[model samples]
Target: MIIAVIDGMGGGIGGQIVNYLRQELPSYFEIYGLGTNSAATSVMLKNHANKGATGENAIVVSVKKANAIIGPLSIIIPNGMMGEVTDKMAAAVCDADAFKILLPISPENFELVGLENKPLMLLIKDAIDLLKKEFNIK
Candidate 1:
């Protein structure tokens, strides 16, 4: 399966997700690091993403080939990630046919109510768990 992990800014979150997923998921699953910038893509690649690409166009094209996509909820929000995510990037991700696993974490301007404010690592773990269940892994 092809899994795409998208991120922006420092790419810390995306790197962590890629690291954890690489450790937990089967090696057969291909992980693509789709970042809003080169720094972000580099981080994910260092964390073991099988492939890496950056910028809006890369994101727009890669998501189409992904079997699943995981990232912060901001990925679908226009101008999210401190304005790193563009409208086209967000629209492409939202419109992709792949299954999405978005963390509830949002930008400062947006508040996602009714959900506990968990740590970043926990949120990632929860997302990975959900993906595992969806694919019948384990």
Candidate 2:
């Protein structure tokens, strides 16, 4: 399956997700890192994503072929990630055919309801667990 990890800014959260997924998932599963900028893409690529692309167009085009999409919840909000994630990118990701696994990592002025303030690692683990459940992986 093709899994896409999307992120912006420093790409720290996305990098962690890619690293965990690379360690946990089988080699056959392809991980695509989509970033709002080259810096984010670089971080994810370093974490072992098979391929990576940057900018709104790259994200929009890649999401079409993704089996699953993982990233911060802010990725879906227009102008999120301090304006790194554009409206077009948010629209494409939300409308993609992939199953979205969004972390509850809130950006400034955006918060998810009923979610406790957990560590980033824990939130990422939840995302990984969701992937395992969706793919029926042990």
Candidate 3:
């Protein structure tokens, strides 16, 4: 399956997600690192994503081909990632047919209600668990 991990800024979150998936899941799955910038893409690539792409156009094109899309909730919010995520990128990700597994990591000036303030690592672990359950991974 083609799984896309999207992130921006320092790309820390995407890198961690890629690393966890590589270590925890079988090698049969393909991980695509989609970043708002080259720095982010490089970080995820170093963490062992099978392939990667950067910028709004790349994200718009790749998200459609993914079987699953994983990223912060901000990915679908236009002008997110400190404006690194463009409207077209947000629209494409939202409109994609792939199943979206979004992390509840809200950006500055916004907050998501009904969710406890959990550590980032814990949130990522939950995401991985959800993926495992959905795919029937051992």
lDDT of 2 by residue, 11-109 (tens): 898999999999888999999999999999999999999999999999999999999999998889998998998999999999999999999878888
Q: Would you list the rank order by lDDT, best first? A: 1, 3, 2
Per-residue error (Å), model 1, residue 43: 0.4
Predicted model with the maximum TM-score: 1
Q: Report RMSD (Å) for each prediction in the order shown.
A: 0.6, 0.8, 0.8
Candidate 2 weakest ten by summed lDDT: 103-112
TM-score result, candidate 2: 0.97
**Steric clash pairs (candidate 3):** none
- Give candidate 1's whole-model lDDT: 0.96
Residue 130 CA displacement from its true place in model 2, Å = 0.7
lDDT of each: 0.96, 0.93, 0.94
lDDT tens digits, residue span 26-133, model 3: 999999999999999999999999999999999999998998899999999999989998999999999999989999999899889999889989888999999989
